[model samples]
Target: MKKILYAIIPILAFSIIFLNMFFGHLVFESETQEVINKYSVYVHLLSEWQSESKNIIFDVTNTWYKSDKIRNTNHVFDAESKEYNSNQLHEINGKSYVELKHEFSDCQEEWQPMLYRKAVDTVRHEIEYVQGQQLSTDPSVSVYPDTENENYDNSEQQSKIKNGFVQFFPICTSKDTTSYNFSVKTDNKDLGFDVYFVSSSDQRENFVNSKFDYYTESGCYGQNKQSYSGTCHDIKKDSGLLVIFPDDLKPWTTKVTVNLYENN
Candidate 1:
């Protein structure tokens, strides 16, 4: 009887732990996001970027990404409010480009205008930020409404808050260019059913699959299981660096330092 009891204890523990881990990934399946603005930054080639002479300017003033739960039938929890606002700087042959700069701010505050310089040198290879020309004047830009309580609940219904860290988990990390399709078909359990790839051409494809690691100055946040903590992630390869956020922590107004790298 004692041996049977001991066996049952292990089984119960496994079940409970597995259930929690599984629950961490649960909210993603039912999530439906409306990407107001998204673009790809090609990081593999450095030589091509250095030779660029065109002066790239902002196309749109503000771009954001937000996700909502389609399964919220009662409309209890407010729409998942997560966004990163940045200017779109395009790379054209006639343009003179310099630094790839980034700034972090939340929804309520007046974000500072990010400054860019033409003189730059770096340790890594190279990267170019593709942006839309209509950023400031674009009529499609939508404002994300605030919620009554910004605090998230800790319950079984809560899943991992990716914190805008979504990566292509398939073959994109292995090569310079990888083409895969995400279908919104409910029957396919491997690929998610919430977000579907709508762009048919690779040039217009806003979704980029790369791995990254993030950290804050105060050590408030660091690398997750899915991210690479080394000098470089999936630089020239396809979906190599899979960045993941903390499962236990909910969204609070916090800032993080994002690093970009390329190979020599």
Candidate 2:
């Protein structure tokens, strides 16, 4: 009987261990699924723009790879006010993310801008849209309406406060010419920046196919447009980099010159 009792103890302990392992796995799988679902839209965007130049900008702007602490912090739903936490959504990947905290003031408090320079640089590469454009105006501009419309009423103001951050995220990072310029090369009338073939007209059809085929091969996402001349043009290449903001984070354009240096 004593031998039987000893055997039963071991069996009970083994059963408990097995149950814990099974339940642990189930919990882990559930959380992973939640996190993945929350990022479904972003993942789709990433997959679509992975190869385009806009992808480079957006990827740099909204980076997911970061320190565990920042990534682990709950940036989604806000339980306190029973609403979404828009502040946490601004962490655009590790490449271009902003950190904003409310400032204290004796009379009236305000939200100061904490511009992330790295994020600005990420957008710089895509500023190749217009070449030789000067930033005559302030890079970041924000404008607000003087009075609210009757239709909006008080609810509109409250709604704006809650959903305001969503508007700011895109505004703060979109088309930012703070430290750089963005312009297309309009100076070159006849010959503009365009994709061409490495082969003659006879093989041009294959060349066109080859270009698009290469984009797909390189894991680029999006549709390729075929020009009247039968050449494929990547339209979505840098569209994502051309985001516009309302009044806040004002728009600015800069000019760049690629000129030859004359040595004395």
Candidate 3:
């Protein structure tokens, strides 16, 4: 009986190991196929949207390094996505502008401006300045209006808002990563400070009403920190992060650094 038990134990161990390997392989394949299917759907919708806007969302300077290096990224699942998501900053006519689109990649190349935060810019009173008008030289300061401020009204800088043709492109962050570094620099100082626009009923009415697919949000139009909730065509259901910043960047000949990290 002892001899039989010993032989049976070895056989059971081998069988268990074999089953795990087989099932694990199937699970991986299943997940991959699911992503591929979702990718197909995204390509269809985004491709159509991309056509409407013309192939060029915004012309940004592209940079290529000889050696592709990875750091603080071993655990990041969507490393490739982060790599493609990096922005291209360039100086044209002394104005700094980063193209507003996802960098071209095997997934898809398109631009849909997602980040929105209230910003303060000094316009020579003639050009038009909103009520919240004030000049600040600090990038670290928090200028975003508090949602709970009952006195909050976009009227501070009310004027004829410039409407640009934009669509829905989500700034996706992976579950494996911690946070994001959505910033750019010229001459090593943060864009004279970063300005942003957020999706408030009053702020992103243009975005929601634009040619974007139907957006269902949990928050009202003017609600602070809300997103137009939904997925592209068939991509996996996931959350989006908008890296909003100022558009009025003063251009300089500085070597800019655009990086994405697991945390800010």
Alpha-carbon lDDT, every model = 0.25, 0.22, 0.26
Per-candidate TM-scores read 0.20, 0.16, 0.23
Off by over 4 Å in 2: 1-111, 114-132, 135-264
The C-alpha local distance difference test score for the whole of candidate 1 amounts to: 0.25
**Per-residue C-alpha lDDT of model 1 across residues 1-264, encoded as one tens digit per residue:** 999999999999887666544442232232333211112222111234331221211111222223231343333422232223233333322322232323223221122121111112111112211122111231222111111112333231124322222222222222353322111111111111112122122211232322322211221122222111223222233222222222222222112212222221
User: Candidate 2 residues 7-90, lDDT tens each?
Assistant: 999999887666544442232332211111000011111222121222111111121111121232323332343222123323
What does the lDDT come to for candidate 2?
0.22
Residue 158 Cα positional deviation in candidate 3, in Å, after optimal superposition: 5.7
Q: RMSD, each candidate, Å?
A: 24.2, 24.4, 19.4
User: What's the residue-level lDDT of 141 in candidate 2?
Assistant: 17
Mark the regions of model 1 whose C-alpha exceeds 4 Å error after superposition.
1-228, 232-237
Angstrom error at residue 145, model 3: 18
Which candidate tops lDDT?
3
Range of the 10 consecutive residues with the lowest summed lDDT in candidate 2: 33-42
Which candidate's TM-score is highest?
A: 3
Off by over 4 Å in 3: 1-103, 106-162, 165-169, 176-178, 184-206, 210-260
